[model samples]
Target: MKTSFSSEFAKRYGLYALVTGASEGIGRCFAEELAKAGVNVVLVARREDLLHTLATHLEGTYGVLCPVIGADLASPEQVEDVFQITDQIDVGLIVCNAGFGTAGNFLDGDIDTELNMLSLNCVAVTRMVHHFGLKFKHKGRGGVVLLSSIVATQGVARSAHYAATKAYIQSLGEGLQQEWHGSGVDLLIVAPGPVETGFAKRSNIQLGKSESPDVIARQSLKALGRQKVIRPGVLAKVLSLALSTAPRWLRIKIMSSIMGSMTKQLPQ
Candidate 1:
């Protein structure tokens, strides 16, 4: 994978890649993988300390530049700041991996937290994609990887808003994939199931099984220019296959049940 990435991926996407939420988890793995493949990375996340640490490590290990950008994407102003900074760099790949999920009953969810999640997961992503998508199209060569989730396939009960946000990304990426078919730009949507990230704890959901973050990152990168959508990892593939042929209502029911179990321990 590293050898292929060093040649094919680097040539296709260019020398520099920008990854959001790059302080940890799948985003961090993506940054590491890209750097290892000889691509410079721009790391964006709210944690400046972590970003700096990771940046230093990647730079030292891979001998590639790692620029750290600390800003909360949930804020529209901050998103602009990120754009302005990144605009100065020659980033050929944009990975929108900075998103969070909310679990538990919709009625019991905090309105502010829900809105913030919307801002970060949807509005921020839309703004980033809109800005970079046009830039990439004009450049005639680039890649865009949008992080979605398996729950995006249906209306997850305990995670309704989170699922909706990912659904938006799924639709957007799918549409752009078609629109950019002959435009020299590749758009890939990564809809993975549970992953062993901070997401489960942060979202207040528990999962019995999950894939490693490296699995998600590697698979997504491998599928970037080759496919429009990929449900990475064995668990994600299995879940997608099982639900793909089900009726919409049944899919929803199954997803709802799964989410309910995950969030059942949370406060009502």
Candidate 2:
């Protein structure tokens, strides 16, 4: 490698990044995109084999070292383990994107399942920001991105719990961004309407004309180093703004109708 400023800085700093849920979706995109930018990536996911494959692909294709950590972020112990691995590295970027959702009535998923989603979406995001925010403060520079949702702007009846969790992420991102400004840490709240990833299959969601993970990931990185919340697609942005002015009952009805169509596509 030529000893350019980038290569020199990367070598001296050992450019590091931590991306949760890296086996798929936005987090996977985050890992690949960062590696493509010459950042050594540490990908965390529950599926060891899948993450290992992703890690190898990034290293082989991007020529950036990618390591995998098998972790269920919903567990405090696992979250701690993730932090321990980063203790010695100067992680300049942290992408908290580990989350899952269940549609239909709030009762569609069991309470235990709901808790898992809550833990992963809201609690885990806060924990990652807390740890990395402090580290960033001490290190003097860093960026954080949290995956929120366009549904977070309103109370989507069919995805009650799911919307609430994303809302928490959105709220946290806004507050942290404001509070951390000039403090050397940038916070990005990503509200992607519908991403074309296995998330639809895993979460049993059906979204037509969804954005790709790469599209969202690129938009997210652009938003970083700047103070702005992000939404993946123009259509999603328009929908979120239109819904903001819509009557509560009407919006719920509209969301419920859309969700109803989605549910019809899923297995019974």
Q: In candidate 2, how many clashes are counted?
A: 0
Over 121-231, each residue of candidate 1 has an lDDT whose tens digit, in order, gives 999999999998888888899999999999997898989999999999999988888888899899999999999999999999999899999999998888888888999
Q: Across residues 105-198, which tens digit of lDDT does each residue of candidate 2 receive? A: 7765689988999999988878888998888888777778888888776677667888899888888888887898888677788888888888
Regions of model 1 farther than 4 Å from truth: 1-4
Error of 2 at 150 (Å): 0.4
Each candidate's root-mean-square deviation in Å?
1.3, 2.9
Q: How does each model score on TM-score? A: 0.97, 0.91
> How accurate locally is residue 69 in candidate 2, as Cα lDDT from 0 to 100?
90
Position 158, candidate 2: lDDT: 67
Compared with the true structure, the alpha-carbon lDDT of candidate 1 equals 0.91
Q: What is the lDDT of residue 137 in candidate 1?
A: 86
